[model samples]
Target: MTACGYRVGGQGASLPTEIKVIAVPAFENRTPWMRLEQRLTAAVMQEFIHRSRYRVVGKEQDADAVLRGAVTSATTTPVIFAPETGRASAVQVAVRVSVELRDRRTRATLYANRDFVFREQYEISSDLDSFFEERDPALDRLARDFAASLVSAVLENF
Candidate 1:
């Protein structure tokens, strides 16, 4: 009972407490990026492990629910324009993801949302080679932060 004079386990009650395991499937990527799926999947797994009360399982059969996600967009655009040749002075990388939560046993959707965007800006470098190399580290950081935010939002009932 939750102070409402209703049994917690009966109909019209609050959500059940038995759902504690989650399976994160490989995210489908609609973008041209070849490895975004792997990156996003890894980040989501890491976030769930770090901050959530639920346990993450690799197999859907082992979990109470499964979380399906898709990377809808990944793009890089010039943020600043160079005055000399009208070239990009800096670049911004953005990623958009859509997520769905479903019960594995009942096959019922619990939640779904889209257009979760995460972006990061990087300074332009004199050499293109160094720019690409440095981009990985920044992207990794951004992915981790984005995953954390997503997980927090889901768990907090947002």
Candidate 2:
């Protein structure tokens, strides 16, 4: 005889069940990148809205908890080079971010990650006339990924 059972995959919510609302204000940008904070903030808020049932807000006073994020640093390094021109053809953009989630009433930190780093590679356009800024697209993707990761970390209390 054999016994069979089913199990769930996720660890489930680790924070207090009383926290039903969260405020995600614009993240601070310590780096030189322009408007990077806005991108990160918007992405994180959107992720929370899409994935969780919590009521997300922009003002801390309107929510039970608040999530604060900051872009610590950003740099782009050449990863691939062009054969003929000997110029950089691809770059790896690395960004460091710090985040914290705290209860508004108690001011207790629910989650904190001081130095979370993420990197992505973007190819440079070969045609100079058609060249466009790749940083924006890369940053957008990075922000989305960071948001998903941040939400997961908070939910898992990691």
Instruction: Quote the lDDT for 45 in model 2.
Output: 91
Off by over 4 Å in 2: 1-12
List candidate 1 segments past 4 Å from native.
Answer: 1-16, 82-89
lDDT of 1 by residue, 57-153 (tens): 7778889988888999989899998788787878888889999878877887776778788887867765667877876776777678778867766
Candidate 2, residues 1-158: lDDT per residue as tens digits? 87676433222267778899999999999988899899889988988888777888999999999999889998989999999988888888788889999999899999999987878787877777545665567678878987887788777777
Pairs of residues at least 3 apart in sequence or in different chains that clash in candidate 2: none
Kindly state the number of residue pairs that clash in model 1: 0
Cα displacement (angstroms), candidate 1, residue 16, comes to: 4.4
Candidate 1, pairs of clashing residues: none
Best by lDDT: 2
| Each candidate structure's count of clashing pairs | 0, 0
